[model samples]
Target chain A: MLKELDPLLHSQLRLGVMSLLMSLESADFTFLKEKTNSTAGNLSVQIDKLSEAGYIEVIKSFRDKKPLTTCKITKKGIKAFEQYVEVLKQYIK
Target chain B: MNDEKNLTPQESLEVITSMIRQAKGNMKKSSFYFLLWGWTIVLANLCVFILIKFTTITNPFLVFGLTIPAAIISVVYGIRQGKQITAPTMLDNINRWQWTGFGFTCFIFAFFGQRIGWQINPVIITMCAAPTFLTGIMLRFKPLILGGIVFWVMGILSFLAPVSWQFLLASFAVTFGYLVPGYMLKKTEA
Candidate 1:
């Protein structure tokens, strides 16, 4: 069954970030930026949005003296992703 | 800063949302390696467990606890994985650990068993404790990390327990390591 998606998460870029997070246990901002080929500013903006949504968590900490920003999928984020995939699958058929 | 900025609050929010969605898509495309590789480690560990339980398993010392034999197997396994299980960032950290947790578990049990006899270490607890700890930090989950910490502390304290205490540690290891966390993984679906 196709389920409702929050309009906020349906955007092209934001959906990309959430989709990545939903599949992974965690990832860094740079990795996400590189994978998406997104500008740093744009990636930062997207991460902030996901963090704000409580769909994903942004953990800021230091490792080996470097400022580190890591992201992980929240339980809510997983549910949203499963629902998102189900909805998208409908279009494939 | 506010006066120079032209975007309305709602407009900015929408922009951010769209950007995140795109990033999520990219992430999905890149993570196939982790899912496949991580599952392999989990499966291999389960296989070893089954093999040991079913086989003659003459040497409990070699088969269970912190044994060098198990660590040897893990190091070879971990090294074989090489870059496929890269753990450069906190995100990759969990992936990096892979089967190394069991390696440590094998080492602790092996060393302890040799001199101290076939007793479980209370503080050492679960062989997977260290890996779980890394996962917690990488995932930014406090409870999971705390659970690892508790298991580790238990491992260290195992040495202090009387002869009977070894069994207690073994039981606790299963309870905290596989049972509790397994339940959580199922319930939370995380």
Candidate 2:
């Protein structure tokens, strides 16, 4: 079961985004981008994938008519991260 | 919390960023505490030497208690001058190393000091200081500062035990024990 999650989470940028978000309740797009070294277009696609999977909640709002995206990890995301670690441990073992 | 319901995504991002900057500032301030404690220790020892030379006073612990409050005030005041760190560095590791060194020094001081013309001071130095430094590093917290306070109070009480050179012990108690730990705390946080 954990094997299913291993590949999805191993992506570098998404991994960085998830790890950073794990430490925080939520994070802005800029923080996620800067930390993960991802371009805007690339991040948007990854975020959408994770959102579609129910792993993250994306909130959008406008300040001065500008769009912003904030990411938050969902319960499913936490479970995935935990299961991902458990599965990864087998590889090292 | 529901205030976000009406605002645009840009406003939400701005609000969260502002929160992050404020939290970052507080954490940065906590890290420089070790630098302040280290300087305070060095200065206190120097002051002790100066006091012993001029006054007929044999015990320096009283002066030590005075010096501590000063250290506290200075730590809070020194916030203005301390460097602000927003990123991680090897310096964070250095913080842990310093406290470990202080713990070892205290243990070594205690072992030897307990054997010979050993005054009560070295023992107090080991007891109060070694743990304080070690705890700060282990916990990586600033508010763990309460440990230093507890150590200081114990050092003062150790003097009333009818021990000779209790004054020497009390002063070293705060200097070697609590202060070293206090200093290491800021470094360990990164």
Candidate 3:
């Protein structure tokens, strides 16, 4: 039997965020926007969805008096990403 | 990039690979500390060699006092750089701890070496090898690994050399151990 794909991570931008977070300790809003090549408004919506799903934690703070948003994957997110990849391999192979 | 579109499995994998590559590429490092320490060590070794050979300086160890300024500069530089980055990678944390450990070990060796009547220079050269080697492994930079091995070899040679000449071996060790690899790290991204 094939595994079901993670609906939370199946979309392109969310998966891109997850993949980037997987490799890094954490990344800021600007960094994620740059890497995802997404506009602020759209990226914010996707980030909120992922946060609501408990796949990522968003930390808002200030750097040099400028507001900063940093995102990191949760343990639940990692498990979901791994399972997503495993299921993806089944489809691609 | 399409933010809301569904991705095919192949496109999904591609996005994963590309994003990971981009993150890795964004890893920032400054060669300032490496070059600073490398030049300082080389100069300290040379200063000792010069004082012992040409001058009638009674205590050549006074040259090592130069490290006081180097340490101050290091601390200031570290603080400034720490403030600059919003996020530090896991590798960055590991590197920081490893070097901090090395710094403590060196202090311990220096403090105890005199009491134990141990030759400090040769022992210091031996101690230098561990951090350089482990750093190489962490960064996947081969020159640093070789440089670490060079420190060990130089350490052994320093043991065989006469007391005054151990300074010369130490000079060679830092030349290869820190400066060469330091420059290479500055040049290479990975």
Each model's chain A TM-score:
0.84, 0.89, 0.95
Per-residue alpha-carbon lDDT of model 3 for B1-190, expressed as tens digits? 7765778889999999998888774555656777898888889989889998999988888778787788789889888887676556777777877787887877787668778674888888998998888878877789889999999999999989998899888888998988998898998845
Q: What is the DockQ of each candidate?
A: 0.05, 0.04, 0.72
Write down the lDDT of every candidate, Cα atoms only: 0.54, 0.55, 0.85
DockQ: the better of candidates 1 and 2: 1
User: Pairs clashing in candidate 3?
Assistant: none
| Total clashing pairs for each candidate | 35, 9, 0
- Highest lDDT, which number? 3
Off by over 4 Å in 2: A1-3, A6-11, A20-32, A40-78, A88-93, B1-32, B49-54, B57-62, B65-124, B127-190
Query: What is the interface RMSD, in angstroms, for predicted model 3?
Result: 1.4
Give the higher-lDDT candidate: 2 or 3: 3
Stretches > 4 Å off in candidate 3: B188-190
**Candidate 1: what is its chain A TM-score?**
0.84
In candidate 1, position A70 carries an lDDT of 84
Query: What is the C-alpha local distance difference test score of candidate 3?
Result: 0.85
Docking band of candidate 2: incorrect
Highest DockQ against the true fold, candidate: 3
> What order do candidates take by TM-score, descending?
3, 1, 2
Error of 3 at B56 (Å): 4.0
